[model samples]
Target: LTTMALVPQVRDAVDLPVVAAGGIADSRQLVAAFALGACGAQVGTCLLVSEECPIHENYKAAVLKAKDSGTVVTGRIGGTPVRILKNPMAKTYIAKEKEGADKLELEEFTLGALRRAVFEGDVKSGSLMAGQVAGMLHEVRPLRAILEELCGGCRGVLERMEKEGF
Candidate 1:
């Protein structure tokens, strides 16, 4: 389930804290998660462009170049859906899926695709895993800067809410 849709439902169903994931990158998202009853937000794709991410430059470049429409959910052929950038590798996988490739064939095709993209900088033949928020990311900034922006954005949002009465 997507973050916004799932977080509240889970939060209401149980009394445990809910940590929302997927499509959460900025402070605005963080605030929205809390407003929707999430106790915290788990951020991943946004960090791919951070200086500390350790992914290949090619992977980072692909993510930086992505727009909201840049990502596609692949791996359906293997019965596991994954969101990744729309690169040559993803296109091939998608085409194969359309041709009714079996799960084993799909697995074989994607074997080492992630490693190639993450370590070998093979964007054309690699799996560039990312999220919808990849479009919001423009530059590779330090982790410190990213944290600061998120926190600052959250604080600003809270202040605005307080002034506007909730």
Candidate 2:
């Protein structure tokens, strides 16, 4: 669904699987989505730590180091509010919010530098695009382990619910 209204509409409009995409982080979300009639989920930020993820080690480190509020939603300068890791670029933009016409274009280049740092391992610059869930990941592990943990957590929750007579 492109927006909230389309979520349920798409879920009911067809019989095929409905995979929730935005803001998904962990097993709880998967279950909640299922409860909402979604058949599956498409994870992005949650997989940044996966061994199979092509992002640089520094990128994953940034994800691991992120706090619950480490990411900021920005994009008004361009268009939409994109969720990105709180980097120097974002910091500068936020600080310049009041400077108005005094803002320098050089600040925008910080994001590009962040890209170089994350994707190319050049920590001196480049911004990493991540979601709020980046804070939930504290370590880098094999993709297999991530999936195993996800499935195991799901099973545990299901077992708990069953024990509760649900």
Number of clashes recorded per candidate: 0, 8
Q: Name the runs in model 2 displaced over 4 angstroms.
A: 1-17, 95-114, 122-124
Candidate 1's C-alpha runs over 4 A off are 164-166
Say which candidate scores most in TM-score: 1
Error of 1 at 88 (Å): 1.2
RMSD of candidate 2 to the truth, in angstroms, is 3.9
The model with the greatest lDDT is: 1
Instruction: Determine the backbone clash count of candidate 1.
Output: 0
By summed lDDT, which 10 consecutive residues of candidate 1 come out lowest?
70-79
TM-score against truth, every candidate: 0.93, 0.75
How much is 9 displaced in model 2, in angstroms? 6.6
Local distance difference test values of all predictions, in order? 0.91, 0.71
> How far is 117's C-alpha from truth in model 1 (Å)?
0.5
